[model samples]
Target: MKERWVVVIGGGAAGMAAAVSAAEQARYLGVDCHITVIEKTHQVGSKIRISGGGKCNVTHVGTSAELLEKGFLRAAEQRFLRSALYAFSNNELRALLQQQGVATTEREDGKVFPVAGEASVVAEAFRTLLQRLKINCELHAPVQAIKVHGQQFHLITLHGDIVADAVIVATGGVSYRHTGTTGDGLRLARALGHTVVEPSAALSSIMVQPHSLVALAGAALRGVAAVARAGKLRAERQGDILFTHRGFSGPAMLSLSRDVANMQRSQREAVHLAADLYPQQLHDELEALLLQHSKKQGGQLVRKFLQVSPIGMLLLKSETMPYGTIPNAMVPLLMRQAALDDEVTFATLSREHRHQLVVTLKQFQLGTVHNVSLDAGEVSAGGVALSEVNPKSMESRLVPNLYFCGEVLDYVGEIGGYNLQAAFSTGWMAGKSAVNKLLTAL
Candidate 1:
């Protein structure tokens, strides 16, 4: 019998998982299979080392496969991740980590991280597992190009040419370029006659045109519903938002960035973001509350109440009240109709203007964003098309014995552990499936 050689490119979360899982499948089947992982960087798990601020978010605590699938943004992504997610579930990954002496903690929002609270610790565990499995690892050996010749794959690299019976391209998307994820997997896949989804920025910060926004650059809002309008797409997310020097960022911004970016790239749509600081309160309810607060805090300066938060310092700077003068509290600035002058107050203002204040608070416009920089994205969305790969096995439908896993695929998940979980799941399936198919044929 021929000794099976499986080559896995990239050694991030997916590549390592694939190598180990492939070896495990071989062992379970009692097949003599050799696995090799070729990493471009000096070390494996480069991305893993930096994830969750060095404390590796292992995966979401969602035990159900359906819930895991729902975390993905696109319908195709959600559907494609189904089989792989079920094959090696979050629970199974958690159990494997626990058995390896790593404890985990689940946050209230379901993000799971190592109890050791160190991403290095998680990376160490993977390295140890690879060693135990005897998987050959080649670091600092980047694959320059990949060519499929009949039943074998020839990977020309900086080190040397590596020929293997099976190959898994686990190189992640072009994000975190320092981590060596420079779309190598996409290039390799495209060379093998696969359709590559045009890559775009995801989880990136938006650049707002309004210059006055810089004043509230550090102001942050929590549990706010951020609704983004781009082209025909209207995406919404609820979380924390940080007003950046350029525009908006943080969880809420990142969550909708991919969708917004995609729309921006595809269609020349005017991208606008609006934040509702209080999602619990309705427009009418907010109006009443604003009036009540205004009446109570009437004696104080206008900038000293919730109205200030609604306007932030960003909107205040736009007003024509001197160059730096703040609206008077007793003046009831929100209740002013004509030209917001020094005369208007709650006592003399019309009811219509008072209601408009509620509208202002409920729809705090972030203004039109000019661009979502691809380089700024945390994860690059869109890679190898989902149609080109088998979701069940993570195998390339066009090329026999060829597999792909991780962000190289045309999928991007919302922030949390969803992306990592998908990578691990698909890699595990691809590894197991590659070896299983080989054994069956042999």
Candidate 2:
């Protein structure tokens, strides 16, 4: 019998997992299988090397099928993921790292990271595992073309061409091209008759118009809520909002950006982002507090009380109020108004202050998104259309002996370890299914 062969393109998290899973499955079945991984970059797992800002958030703490199901975009995709996630939960992944000499620590938010605080450790674990399995790794061998021949795949690389019985396209999406995710997988899949969804940036920063209030850059307002509205539809997220020189970031802004991006794309209008700095407290509470404080410190300037929150200070400063002149009565009224209304209106800070306070605060809207820069993206949204692929095998319905895993497929998750989890899960299932199908054919 001819030796069974499987070729996995790309060597990021998905590719590594697929290659490893295929090799392991073949070993368990007592079948001779050659598993090869092709990476365009000099090193494998480049994206993993920089994931979580180098801390390498491997996976989230959610282990239940339902919670894990919430991570993917489609219901069927989530259902398909359950088996792989169960096979390798967060606990199991952590244990695997421990065995590889990399200890993991979980944050209060349930994000698991390596003790060394470097994504390279996670990459090392994958590399070590593949090495132990004797998987053939071809780094810097970027595939230029893929030709499907009857029951085999012919991959044309810069070095040369190689034929394999099965192929796994795990080349990821078009984010962080520097990390070797250049959307090659999507293109390759498309050439093979798979429908590729136009990719967009997910978990990315929003670019707001520059206002003098942008001076408040670097200030993070925690526990603040932001509502991104298109028309009747709105999405709200309450988290830390960080002001950046360009626009806004942090969890709140990142969460809002997704809806804003979608709205901007569909409506072709400026997306509205309203920030409620005090979401928990009611207008009456703020009004009462302000009234009490005003009476207690009748002589003290409002600016002094405003110093309690940097946002308050910015608001006062934007209104052109000198440090000592703002009245205590006005402070409470402003707070009350901000708390009561979903949108807080601010008077112009200056006749021509260059930063429109009202525009920056309440009407802080941004025009249609020109383009989401790939380099700044956390993950790429959209890939191979899920309808054309079988959820059970991650294999294309249009093609035989071909599979896709990771961001290369039309699967994306919100920030956290959701994307990584999906990649691991899909890769594992695809690997096992490919091996099973190959054996069945034999």
Candidate 3:
């Protein structure tokens, strides 16, 4: 039998995983198969190196069900990702890293990171695995186009052309172009008769309309429920949120930015952001707390209870009910919004004043969203439409022997390690399916 070649484009998480899976499968099958990874940049795993502020959150620690519920919010995407996620799970990925001498630690929030605490360690582990597997990795080789010639795939690159029996397009999305992901895979998929979902920014800080909150830049609120509404479309997320000079960022804002971006595209209506400073407290419960506190500490200044330091407030749990805190800087802002004087005490508080205070705290407006930054996005949303690809194998339904995985696909997981996990699982499936297709043909 001839030495069949499998060429994988890009060297990010998905492409590297595909190459490794293909090589391992070929070795296990005792076939004379050669695997090649073509990366446009000089180094592989550029995204991994910068993810999680360089800590490289490897994967989230959870079962498939938990991951689906938390990471994938949409039913269609969850259904599509079920098989791949179950096949090559977070546990299996961690185990693979462990086998490559990369120890991992799970944080209290279920985020997994390298014990060494440097992203370079994780990237180096993949490089070491590739070396041990003896897979050929061609750096500085950017594929210009892929021309199909019957059973063979001719990949035209900047350096030269390489013919392969099968190809995996994991070139990723347009976010972080400096990392070498510049929508090459999306263009290729479109050229090959696949429907491409116009890519948008996901997990990016939102730029809000200029308002008083701009002065509170660097202030943050923990575990707040934020809701963004554009026209009739509404999206909500609960987590930590930071006040930026332009608008807001952090887990909650970043997660909901996807919907904001989509809404901007769908309609011309302005997007507005509102947050519940006390998400855990119901309106009636919070109102009662205010009333009860007034009776107990009638002499307490109104400013004293509402004030939070600029450093922000952490979660405070009492014996029965919990209290959520807002930024100290927000105290004056909220007081102004409620038309209350800072010198006023609970003893002098009127019925209307108390009601207004509660209402202002519950629905604090963060202003309108002006834009979602694609360049600043952690990952790009939208890609090759899921309908054109097979989830079980990560193979293209329209083009045999062609496959896709990672950010190039339309599915976008929430903040955490879900996106990386999806990349690995789908990449593994694609690689295995390509090998199977070749073996059956022979």
The global C-alpha lDDT for each of the candidates, from Candidate 1 onward, is 0.80, 0.73, 0.87
- Sliding window of 10 residues with minimal summed lDDT for model 1: 321-330
lDDT string, candidate 3, 94-145, tens digits = 9999998999999999999999999988888988898999989999998999
Cα RMSD of predicted structure 1: 5.8
Q: Across residues 55-75, which tens digit of lDDT does each residue of candidate 2 receive?
A: 778887766474466555457
lDDT of 1 by residue, 1-442 (tens): 8899999999998998899899999998888999999999999998999887788888887755655555785677888899988888999888888878888999988899999999987788898999888999999998988887878888999888999999999999998899999988888888789999899988888788874456667766666778888767788887778788888888889888887786777677688888765666777776675567557655543334434443222321244422122223412423342234344455443467666555655566777878787776768888999998999999999999999999999888878888888899999999999999888878
Give the C-alpha miss distance for residue 175 in model 3, angstroms: 1.1
Best-to-worst order by lDDT is 3, 1, 2
**TM-score list, all predictions:** 0.88, 0.83, 0.95
* Leading candidate by TM-score: 3
RMSD for all candidates, in order, please: 5.8, 6.8, 2.3
lDDT of 3: 0.87
Lowest-sum lDDT 10-residue window in model 3 = 308-317
Number of the predicted model whose lDDT against the real structure is largest = 3
